[model samples]
Every structure is written in C-alpha cells, then in structure tokens.
Target chain A: MSEIIRLTTPLKDEDIVKLKVGDNVLISGVIYTARDAAHKRMIEALEKGEPLPFDVKGQIIYYVGPSPARPGRSIGAAGPTTSYRMNPYAPKLIALGLKGMIGKGKMSDEVKEYCQKYKAIYFGAVGGAGALLAERIKSAEVIAYEDLGPEAVRKLVVEDFPAIVVYDTHGGDLEEMGKLQYRE
Target chain B: MRVVDVSEITEAVAKLCIDANYNLPEDVYEALKRALDEEKSPVGKSVLKMIIENADLAREGVAPICQDCGLGVVFIEIGQDVHLVGGSLKEAIFEGVRRGYREGYLRKSTCHPFTRANVGDNTPPVIHYDIVPGDKIRIVVAPKGGGSENMSMVTMLKPADGLQGVIETVVKRVDEAGGNPCPPIIVGVGVGGTFERSAFLAKKALLRHVGKPNPDMELAKIEKIMLERINKLGIGPMGWGGTVTALAVHFEMEPVHIASLPVAININCHAARHKEIVI
Candidate 1:
C-alpha cells in the first residue's frame, strides 16, 4: 500500500525522497507545462550550455497541450498527455535538477532508472479529466515557445492538483502492482 | 433524386460537433458506471468516480469532459438517391467544425504532423463519406483524443496465422500501451479487411455502445473472450491496480482474400466522445 503525500510550493528533492510507486499525492504549488515540442527546445538549450528560459531546479513539468480557454477562464480543460513521448527527453531534464513529471503512461527503463538515481517522481494524472484538472489551476501564463501554440511552455499556479505516483525514486511502479494483482 | 442544401447539412454537422464534444453518450456513461461498481481497487474506484463526475460536469456546462476536444472526425453516409445542393458537402462540414469549435470553446488540435504547426480554427476536418441506400443523410461526429489514438495499431498477418495470432497481437499492443491510452479503455478490433479498411473498421467498431456485443455471434464471442483476457492483464482503470482495466471490447470483421488477414486495433480512452444525427 502507498501513502498519501501532501506537497506544497517549491518542491525539493527531499520532499520526493520517500515517494514510491503507487503513492497518492495532492500537490499544491506552481508547475510548468511542456509537451513534445517544448521539451525539445528546453533540452537543446541545456545541451548548448545556454541558460534555460525558466529555472528547472526542484520543478515539476506537466506534459499537456490544453484547449483554448473560454472567456474569464485562466486555462481550458487541461489534462496530462501521454508520457512515453517524453521518454527521450525526461532523463536529461532530471539530470538538470528536475524533481518530478506529471503525465499519463509508463516511462522508459532509462527514465525509471534516472528517477531512482536522482530522487525524482513520475506522477500520473487522470488522462481525460482535463476540465476537472483545469479547475485546480488558479492561473496560467505562457512562458516560452509561444510559436508552438498549445505546445508552448507555461507557468501555472495550481491548488490541490491530484495525482498518483506511477513511478518513484525507489524504482517501484504502479503498472507492476496492478499486473501482480490481476495476473492469473 | 432528392436535393439537400449544404446549409442544412452544415447546421446538422455543427450541432453534432457540439453535442458529441459536450455530452457523453448514454451507453458509454452506463459502461463507466458499471466499471465503477466493478472496480476493486480504491485508487481505481476513485479514478472512475472522477471520470463519472467529469462527464456530469461537462453535461451541466461546468467544463468539458476533456481539454483535447480533438480534431473533428466526421463520417457521412449519403443516400445514393440524394444530391447535395448550394455548395460542396465537404466544405459545409468543415465550416460546421469551425463554428462548433469556436462557439463551443473546444480546442483546435489539428496540426502538421512533422512541422507541428497549428492550423488555426481547426478547419478542414477529416471527412469519411459513404453512399448508402436511403434518401436521407446520416452523420456521426466522434472527437478522438490523442492519448487513445497513439495506442492504436495495425498489423498484417498471413491467412494461416488465424485467431490465435490476432489475439496475441492485440494483447501485445495493449500491454505495450500500458497507461498511455488511459486504462479502463474500450478496445475496438477490426479483422480480415484490407489494410486501410481494417483500420477504418476498427475505428467504426468503437462507435458501438460499450459492453454491447456485436450482432454476429461469433464476433461477439471473440469480443467477450478478448475482454476477459485484456482485463486479466491487470491494467486497471488509469493503469492503477484493479479488475476493471477495460470496460469493453468491440470487434468488426470483413471478408478478405484467402492469402491475407489484416488486423487493426483502435483504443478509446474512458471519454469515448461521440454523437450522431440524421436528416
């Protein structure tokens, strides 16, 4: 059984140290959004020894490209996209002090290993619960890659953002947990 | 031949786009409700609850069920005896999609596959048309999200490969998909058609009400067996541990040449947004 962890703003490596697969986390803080295209640019900037657009240390990145917001709304129905697409870029970010990732789907072996080595957690948000999830985001502003449209990077203030730990620093996985329970 | 004006078709298509995006189909809603009851894990149950609540919120005008309203996918069935008047049928459908996405506050998700550039306003929907027997037009709008579409696969196997081959391929695909397509998914399998046709049938099969069996007893039996095996994979709702990995499996089959057997599997996440209108 996994424990529920309450996380606040300015997440730290120590805050995620005890997190294991199958844990439930209710996060309250600011998180940045980046999908496939944005991730590429961030990593490319890092590789060139150039300064990143935003400080990634102790930060969590959500993989999402939301719909256009309606009138008076800060953001549209915002839900996590598949994480596997970010597998190639995730470990690189983790090495740069990134503490967590929020999305749906399993990570690559390298990503899992990086989490175990670097004290990062992989959080799974309800895949289609965009509208409900968006309700948690108090505000949002485009931060980088404006030309990428929905794929641009954005800074968001969220409250009680719900997620489950799919992968943890301890190398555990919820996918394995379920498979064990259901395996005949 | 009867003539149907493009403007009328546009109105029908527009309504379909909005309704399909906003409301969860009754059959799909029932399936999710049933899954919530059957789900064993606390986490799985909670996830299911949130999904149900999301649907309710969307219906109540609180929010959309999902943010990715998806590129408009329209399937049109025109009666052979009827002619479209005033303008191109395709253009009118595109206009409807544009208006619906704008008025409904649904996202415009279409982009260039390689360049990844957005086509503003979500125009030029993917329209599939077929001529049928009636003098009336039938339109179905299914907004397929990216997560589920990413998990879809198409495989071509030898005729000698048979049923077992089909089963193994599907299982492999689902296993590989893991939590990506979102668990408690609905699996749609298309068998025996040509390559493209098989893919089409797989997507079309998703239109069936969840947990409802195919009319063909043999295919229905296959669906049941596949459903049992897939759930047994332990990929529960949202890929968390539970007994309700997939709410249902739907299959559509067509005759193929003796030398070839093609299979395609299209997965739909819990949302499964779709609606239909006829005129």
Candidate 2:
C-alpha cells in the first residue's frame, strides 16, 4: 500500500526518504522549472565550479517548458516533460543534494541508482494536464536562460500540485511494481 | 477549373491551427475516459484520471493540454477541379501557421535540425497536400509534440520476416521508448507502404479516433492484437507500468514492392491534439 503525502518546496532530505514508489503526493510551496537546455546549463555550471543560477540544495526541479501566459496570468500551460532527456545530468544533481525531481517518463538506471543512494524521489505529474497543473502555480518568474524561450528556468510557487512517486529513495519503482502485476 | 482563393485557404488554415491546438477533440476525450475505466493498475488509473481532468480543464479554458504546443502539421486534400488564386498556396499556408501560433499563444517549437536555432514564429508548417476527386477542400491539422515525435521509428524488414517481425520491432521500439513518449500512448503503425509513404501513413493513423478499427477487417484485427501485446509489456500511463500502456493501436497499410516491407511507428502522447475542417 502507498501513502498520500503533501510535500512543500525546498523539500527536505528526510521528506524524500519517507516517500516510496506508488505514493500519491500533493506538492505545495516552491518548485523550480527546467528542461533540456536548463539541465545542460546546470550540469555545465557544476562542471566549471561556478555559482549556479539557483540553489539546488534541498530543492525539487520540475522538467517543463510552459507556454506563454496570457495577460494577467502568472503562468501558461504547465505540464511535465519527458524525464529521460535529463538522465545524464540527474545523478550529478543528486550528488549535489537535490532532493526531488518532478517529471513524466522512466529514468535511466544511473538516475534510479542515484536516487536510491542519495535519498531522493522521482515524481510524475500527469503529462498533458498542463492547464490544470498551471492553475496550481500561483506565481512564476524566470530565473535563468531567458533567451532559451520557453526552456528558461523559472521559479514557481504552487499549491496542491499533484504527482505520484515513480521512483523512491529505497530503489522501489512504481513502474517495475505495476508491470509485475500485469505481466503475462 | 474551380477557383480557390489563396486568402480563404490561409484564413481557414490559421483558424484550424488555433482550434486544433486549444481544443481536445470529442472522440479523443471519450477515448481517454474509456481507457481510465479499463486500465487495471491503480497507479495507471490515477494517471488517467489526471489526464481526463486536465482535458476538462482545458475545455473550460483553464490551461492548454500540454506545455509543448508542438509543430503545426497540416494535411490538405485539394479538389482536383479547384485552381488556386491570389497567391502561392505554400506561402498562404505558412502565413496561416504564423498567425495561428501567435494568436493561439501556442509555443513556437520549430528549430533548425542540426544547429538547433529557433525558427522565430513557428512558420513553414509541414504541409502535405494531395489532389483528390472532390469539389471541397479537406484539411486535417495535427499539432505533433516532440516527445512522442522523437520516439517514432521507421524500419525496412525482409519480406520473409512476416507479422512476427513487425510485432517484435514495434514492441522493441515502444520498450526502448519506455516513458519518453508519455504512455498510455496511442501507437500508429504504418505497414507495407513505401519508405516515405509508410511514415506518412503512420502519422495519418494517429489522426484516427482511439480504439476505432480500420474498415479493413484484417488490419483492424492486427490493431487489436498489437494493442493487447503492447499493454502486456506493462508500460502503463506515463510509462509508470500498468495494463494500459496504449489506449489504441492504429494501423495503416498499402501495397508495396515485393522487395520491401517497410514499417513506420508513430506515437502520440495522451494529448493527441488534432482536428479537421472542410471548406
């Protein structure tokens, strides 16, 4: 059985430890958005030992590149992007004390191993539910790579953001577990 | 010759692009609902619930279905009797695409393939036009996102390889794809057509309503079988593993040369944003 938990932004290492595969979570507070371009920059920054644009410690990074907001709207359609593209960079971030990742799709083996070793959790939001998800984002501001267009990194404040645990700190994966039940 | 004004076509194309991007078609909505009910994994079911809810919210003008609005793919079936007037047909279509992306507030995702430079306004839509025996023009607009588009595959198999080879290849492609294309996906399989035609047919197959069978009984059966086998792979909604990896398997096939058995697989995310208009 899986438990439903509410996670706030700047997620703690302990909080991530408590999560397991198949857990349903309603995340609130702050989450940072980054996609392929941002991920590349983040990793590059780490490699250069330069100051990162944002503090990743005890933070959750969401893989997304939202649509442009209409007037008066803080953010536009905000759905999770595929996570596999971030696989190469994820372990390094995990080594940096990153506590959580929010996206859709399967993680690479290295990513899964890092999550287990570093006590982090991988959560999946509904992939196409951008409009609904955007509704939960109370505010958003570009933090880096403005020229990358939608792929820019944005600091987001959200409330009741829905997600489910696809990978957990203990090496349990909802994807693996679910497959076992249905496999012929 | 019937004269068709280029301006009229441009306006219609623009509207179709915006409409297709913003609205989730009725048939697609129903298909997701049915998938949710039939999905066996609790986790998968929950994901489907979110997808359905997202669609409802999009309909209510709450949000766009997905963040990636995708490249504008326009398929035009021109009436053979019609003669284009006023301006270049291709230019008119491109103008429509530009206006639509801007007005719709949709993302501009097009870029140079190798250099990876943005194309500014998402112009130069991938227009596939065909002249047919008709008095009316039929346009089908499908905005294909990169995630699923990236997962698409084309292969040339030996003639003796048979259906088993086709099945194995598709399964491998999806398996390698894992959650990248955003399961529960809709798999569009194009078999037997020439290399390029197979790819075209694969994309066209995605325009069909989920779970709807082909008129050809043989092809329809193949669709069902493939659907079952894919689900059995245990890649559920969003690739989290479950009994509903694919909501539907659509196959489009045509006769090909004896030497070739070309197969193309195109995957559509849960969003499956597409719409049609006739003028």
lDDT of 1 by residue, B1-279 (tens): 988899988888788878887799999899999998998788889999988888887787655778888778899999999988998888899989988888888888888888878887787788899999979999999998888998999989987889988988888898778888988899999986589999999999998888889999999999998898888887888887788888889999999878889999999999998899889
Q: Each prediction's DockQ? A: 0.73, 0.73
- RMSD to native, candidate 1: 1.4
Best-performing candidate as measured by TM-score: 1
Best by lDDT: 1
Deviation in angstroms for B243 in model 2? 1.8
Over A35-138, each residue of candidate 2 has an lDDT whose tens digit, in order, gives: 88788888888789897888888889999989888777998899989898899898988898888899987889899999999888899888888888999999
Model 1: pairs clashing at backbone N, Cα or C within 3 Å: none
**Candidate 1 structure quality by residue, lDDT tens digits, A51-166:** 88788889999999887787888988898999999999999999988889999888899999999998888999998888788889999999899998888899999999999888
TM-score of 1: 0.97
TM-score of chain A of 1: 0.96
**Model 2 off-target regions past 4 Å?**
none
